[model samples]
Target: MTPPRNVHARAALLMLGSTLGFGLMAIFIRLASKDIPTWEVAFFRNAFGFLSLLPMLALPALRQPRPAAAFAASVRTDQLPRYVIRTAIGIASMFCGFWAIAHLPLAQAISLAYSSPIFVTIAAILMLGERVRARRWTAVALGFVGVLVIVRPWSHAFSLGSLVAVAAAVLSALVAIQIKQLSQTDKADTIVFWTYALWVPMSLLPSLFVWRWPAGIEWLWLAATGLMGTVGQLLWTRALKLGDVSALTPISFMQLPVVTLAGWLLFGESVDGATLLGAGIILGSTFYIAHREAKLAREQRSKAPSEAVEPGS
Candidate 1:
């Protein structure tokens, strides 16, 4: 089904803006890597991002006023443990992704990370019990083939950096799954806030092993990393609010090209044809999966009973 015309337009614009910010974020991560350790880089990024969201949280509109009975009934305090687990998983994903960015060619790293949606589709089938049609399965198979093209396992031995990039994508898929689970009971802001709250400690742990003070110019890079992340998150929040996620998801594929161009022009790295080809395949598969899922969800909603059933019955 087509989304509303306004929603479609908003999704296109918002996702485009968010993706450009994400691409710039990749460039900042590379620049910061020159003098700062990846862990510290992750730490500052999370720290400044956390700091930046404070004002938004203070806004009256974002804070819902609750009656004592309604608050107790709607809020599930028992879900705290689940929130912590999701936060830990997210932090680990962040660490691995940052490490990959520091070590691999930026375009290659971004392309590999783009494989997360393929993993996400698989995870949805296995863990969420979501049904997948044959075409999506074929797309998933083709997507992995594309990954192998980028990795070229048969050519030479695997490069650890490239492998790390693949690992980042896989871990990010897991993180996305965890977030999906958490979203059943938690608001998006709550989940995102807890992620950084948990990140500071987990990210700081790695710094103990390889901490390095930033040089004068390095400070600028680190600050940009943090600031860009906060800006990206804000754009994402607004984007998702303005448009349905399924509509916006496909537009995010633009990040690969944007990041690739930034890598070449700013860092003098080449954007190879093979990486672009693989990214195209992966992104195509992901978009198909998202489109299918949206169709399934709409069908399910249309089938719901006129009167809602009790939670257990």
Candidate 2:
């Protein structure tokens, strides 16, 4: 077995890889947006992303002998409703996110999107009836403060694109909650496969209304966006599989700097002080929440055997 430290190192590296892939995906999305409608970009992103998975789906058959079983295992007919809802919400999230990225500075858009964890906490309380202790509540409060700082309402800095980005974050949080629920009954691969399968059609519906042919280089950018997204998801899943989520969670913040640099170099975008401050506050709160959850999980595991033992052994 791998040592715990090595496992953590590997997970961290995988997370870095995931962040880089996602950052590049954002860059490509921005690039494609220059020549195509946001809806068209969304459609091609999902379509090509689904196509990218075809080789991986077939690889199991090439290595082993059971092609039919490999293909069948990827689909879960019983979970159609859940998959549909997830994809529907995901399509909305992508449309809003693509539009936001296309209009706003890349780093600003990314920081705003990272606010999903804050919304996820709120969703758990309202939807799942999950109890929030005082510290978590405080963290949630500070997270919102961070968001306000970034948005800076009543200021010239805020725009419709900023609100759209926040909406995307909320939608993304809803999808995250749905994925958590689905995880109780579905294998990770099955969930991923269904996302692409359902998303391809749902995302296409919006594109149909605003269709435009990609002009030469736009096609390449669109393909890169799709490929990057798929690779990023795979790397993120592998990182979680390899190590503790709490330990790996912070590594994702690496994307902020990566995207910031990409935006500066590629698009002449600069990060302002307020945006940096807000991102720091938001990330700090989320990190605290993650740490607390990990600590509580550890405490529960430590007590499990004692609680399970008979009163008088």
**Which numbered prediction scores highest in TM-score against the true structure?**
2
Global lDDT scores for all candidate models: 0.76, 0.86
Model 1 TM-score, 2 decimals: 0.88
Candidate 1 clash pair list: none
Stretches of candidate 1 above 4 Å error? 1-4, 61-77, 306-313
> Any idea how many clashes model 1 has?
0
In model 1, how large is the Cα lDDT of residue 272?
Answer: 68
Model 1 over residues 1-313: C-alpha lDDT tens digits?
A: 7568888687678778888878778889999988788889998888777777655654533445654444344433457777677667777778789988887788888888988888887787777776666788887898897788788787773576788788878878888888888887777766666776677787788787898888888888877887778777778888877776677887787888787778778788886677778878877777777776666665556767674322100
Q: lDDT value for candidate 2?
A: 0.86
Off by over 4 Å in 2: 1-3, 61-64, 304-313
Evaluate residue 54 in candidate 1 and report its C-alpha lDDT on the 0 to 100 scale: 54
Residue 127 local lDDT, model 2 = 75
Q: What TM-score fits each model?
A: 0.88, 0.93
